[model samples]
Target chain A: MKTPLIDNLQYANFSPAIFEQMRAGGVDAVHVTIAYHETFREMVLNLERWNRWFEDHPDLIFKGTTAADVSLAQKTGRTAIFFGFQNPSPIEDDIGLVEICHQLGIRFMQLTYNNQSLLATGCYEDDDTGLTRMGRAVVTEMNRVGMVIDMSHSGERSTLEAIDHSTRPIAITHANPHWWHVALRNKSDAVLKALSGAGGMLGFSVYPHHLAGGSDCTLDSFCAMIAEAAARYGAEHLGIGTDLCQDQPDSIVEWMRVGRWTKGIDYGEGSASNAGFPPMPSWFNDNRDFGNIRTGLLNAGLEIAQVDGIMGGNWHRFYQQGFGPA
Target chain B: MKTPLIDNLQYANFSPAIFEQMRAGGVDAVHVTIAYHETFREMVLNLERWNRWFEDHPDLIFKGTTAADVSLAQKTGRTAIFFGFQNPSPIEDDIGLVEICHQLGIRFMQLTYNNQSLLATGCYEDDDTGLTRMGRAVVTEMNRVGMVIDMSHSGERSTLEAIDHSTRPIAITHANPHWWHVALRNKSDAVLKALSGAGGMLGFSVYPHHLAGGSDCTLDSFCAMIAEAAARYGAEHLGIGTDLCQDQPDSIVEWMRVGRWTKGIDYGEGSASNAGFPPMPSWFNDNRDFGNIRTGLLNAGLEIAQVDGIMGGNWHRFYQQGFGPA
Candidate 1:
């Protein structure tokens, strides 16, 4: 089979069109964000809605629970949509819900989003208090249940502590090297090194805001950054998790950042003038443009095997290793 | 360990005082009703509150997740509080929540209370539709997850269908036999026979409204009724689920019967004259009075083994067999 093309993160305004595009792009699997600052019930409702979508678009996409589903999706010519939570709000304060959410096909969960959560301090928190008591317990449970702990949007201290606490390899599913671009959401080289050293994966983000030149970043520059990271860390631990927020309404940013916690709008990273999804780079606008990334990586002097691994084979291997009872 | 005292059902006005009473009564465990007619989020909030209670009163109580917890509670000199739901509202429309509720330590859940629900028909429904499509899926999921299906307040046909459909033995956790009292909420002879015949349990109710003489019923008479049931259904499948709704405000009954489904009060089973909680029988009023019934059973000519099994041993064994993946 052709090397599986997987994007480790996306929170698209899902529709039949998106599923069709996923199939068109030959994307074998996509870790779709199903919850951000949603309560448990609300998250279930979101799953229910996705269930409807799966039923409505069976030919184009299928719900993925195991790593085997990626190959199944490839065999069936469909995209395996793996569920993930951008924030741990779906579990709320309940530790037991970690397994419950896993049982419901949630393959990944972040301890925090962009602010302080019950579990840990988010990237936006000034104090960075690290993992809470509940956070430690939840990490144990998550590791036991095979729910990948994604510290993509968590503060540095909490992220490092989570790495130390979790017995299983975790992931920074969507972020870039802060050495390349000093975005708050990007990971420091020390954090990235610690993560990769512990056999964890780093899914380089294509979310413009984390890019060195934002939306105007060139394909050559992006690929060069990936090449540098591959040389620094190992290419086996590198993959793409394009933090695509395709076709979302501008208003959803408020819900994503503020949720029910605030009466006033909190524009995270983006200000009032640009409080919406930033423009995609000219080289990659949607799932269909993933081929450009493959070509760009090769043009940046990476060998075929390393480029193939960075494209999706690494994530497919990670999924096989991580998405099961530890 | 010394005839383990277990109340199969209760919706008490829970406080530290109640926990103290449970320990004072030497109750090993209690299947306390945590949700009547709550949505999934509301039910989670209730669990969160119970988690606090477990934290605050660890000396008197602990959250019970398995039958082993009964012996643990006995060894620790604390009551194990097992959770139940009097209605399926906690799951709402998602069948996935069956395992979720089980993970959160909810051991039992009624298909319906005193009105028509998404799962099955309650006793008050003129037309008993039995289990819906979602109901069958939920039942199978519940059985798989080891969440006991309690048809205590469900209609006859629905109760029978549930028993027939469920691969694992189900329970009528809080109802007396209609042959003895003829109350609307009591189980019929056919249900009791079918239940116990199929390895299910019949938890005899101590709620005054289901008693032959209401609040005036003697302990001897109640025990005699249980003795009769033992003679009919065998002593091993008999237990007590008092339905002890103690210390709750009169206004709370409205929420129990109507929930958010209706704008007006539903004086279900009880008339307007008797809308609130009926007074408990003089013999058994609170958790502290469980010993009275135990003594009354011995006085009513039950063998020590039969009496002990009827008290709690049967339920404990049932818990062992029932609370795991079937």
Candidate 2:
């Protein structure tokens, strides 16, 4: 098989153009966030919209329900779109809906976004009470139904609880190590160690705020961080989840951060001076620029196998293992 | 609290008259088969129709999503209608739909109807292949999502495998012991032994074909059979599933057996001479006659507690244990 190229997470402004760019980048599969704060019915409506997209764009993209679909996309020269949720709002109070969303091809879901939820505490919360009663049950249900738990936006205590409680591996689909960049969203060495120790993959993020020097972060520096992660946690556990919010309107950031919970603006990552999507680094602007990272990793002293694994091979393997019943 | 009276399974041509009969019968809850061979989308339409029924008949009936709803219905003096499937066709080939149907309040789903399905072999299939690859996975998913695996219409080997594989107790939502009646649809002693031994429940079927004397089967004899079952298996494993098909048109029988799979008609339990639904036994012709069985059981020398367990308490307890994550 041609080394499969997969991006574990992205909440992109998806359109035919973005799909075409995925094809241009030789990307076989992309896990896309289909829900942030949408209710179950609203998430279903979003799925309906995606169903229409699949029907409309058969040659460009196909809905992927399993990791095997990655190879299918590679052979057919199309992109396999895997659905995910940035928050557990779609499931609401019902744990039964975890399987329903998984059935609808949602392969991943975060227990928390940026606050306390029925399941877990989020990163911004002052005290992380960890996984709630419902959260623990939902995790077992999700594991049984082959849905991966993503703790990217969850607090440390909650994330640790999830990694320990989940019988199957859980992921942090988009974030860097706090050791590299001291952002609240970035994970600690302890979390990453426990994650990889439990066989879970960590997809390094390319969001501007997650980078060391903001939007001015160099490709060499980013690749160097990857090499360090590989040295510490083993190369097989590393992958990419570019956190790309491309072509989105500034208003969407407000909806993403505030949803319907607050009346005032909550500028996430971006302050009042820059309250929207920060400019993406020139080196990796869109799906078509994925090759730049591969080249940068090769120049940053990574072996070809390690670089290939980080690019997509690792995720392809993870998808194969994670997208089915344990 | 009055002991909740719940029927484990029924498929009737429901109307306001039936609701009135349920009220008169004092039935607190009932597991109603919503799909025979319908696909997931088609099953959803059936649920929508049921939703309208709940809205239209609020005084007589309400939708039951949990065991607590049974008590709610008792307090409200209306029957709580619990959804189920007589066959796994609603989920088709996807293991994910087990949870989706559960989310829609479906409590029981049979592995097969009267022929081989993707998951398991039906009673009518000559060769029993047991659980298919998808069937094993679906069982775990069902176990996780709290959807009961029903083997009422499935073949012996497949039924045994399901009992073995499911960590949670499985159910035969509507079927009788073959020792009582030689109908192929009736389960064998081996199957019942395995079922009850594994903490599973066996809901006795009252359909004419599965009874010793067909439509003339007496309440005394039916209660005597229950007494025998209680001797063989614990009373905790027994409940009423009636298999009542009241007021259904003849065309529905054909649809239930054949669906869209074949153009020709299938007689199912009814032979060429007695096609369509056999006349219901006189002692239990409708929901209003449930009290007759209760009296008969009392007359048949069973304790009040055992009779109550056989009537509904067993299923009420099952609903409590079986409707949540293990």
Per-residue lDDT tens digits of candidate 1, residues B1-326?
58788888888899988888898998999999989888887777687677668657879998898999999999999999999999999888878667667757889999999788899999988999999898898899888779999999999999999999999999999888999898789989999999998899999888788999988888888999999999999999999899888899987877888888888878876788988888888888899998899899999899999989988999999999999877
Q: Which residue runs does candidate 1 get wrong by more than 4 Å?
A: A1-34, A37-39, A46-84, A88-151, A154-174, A180-184, A188-326, B1-3
How accurate locally is residue B159 in candidate 2, as Cα lDDT from 0 to 100?
94
- State the C-alpha RMSD over the true interface residues for candidate 1, after superposing those residues: 5.1
Where model 2 places Cα greater than 4 Å from the true spot, the runs are B1-326
| Top DockQ model | 1
lDDT of 2 by residue, B141-190 (tens): 88876888999999999999999999999999888889987999998999
Q: Which candidate should be chosen as best, given TM-score against the real structure?
A: 1
Q: Which pairs of residues have clashing backbones in candidate 1? A: none
**Model 2 residue A281 lDDT score:** 85
Sliding window of 10 residues with minimal summed lDDT for model 1 chain B: B95-104
Fraction of native contacts (fnat) of each candidate: 0.05, 0.00
lDDT of 2 at A82: 94
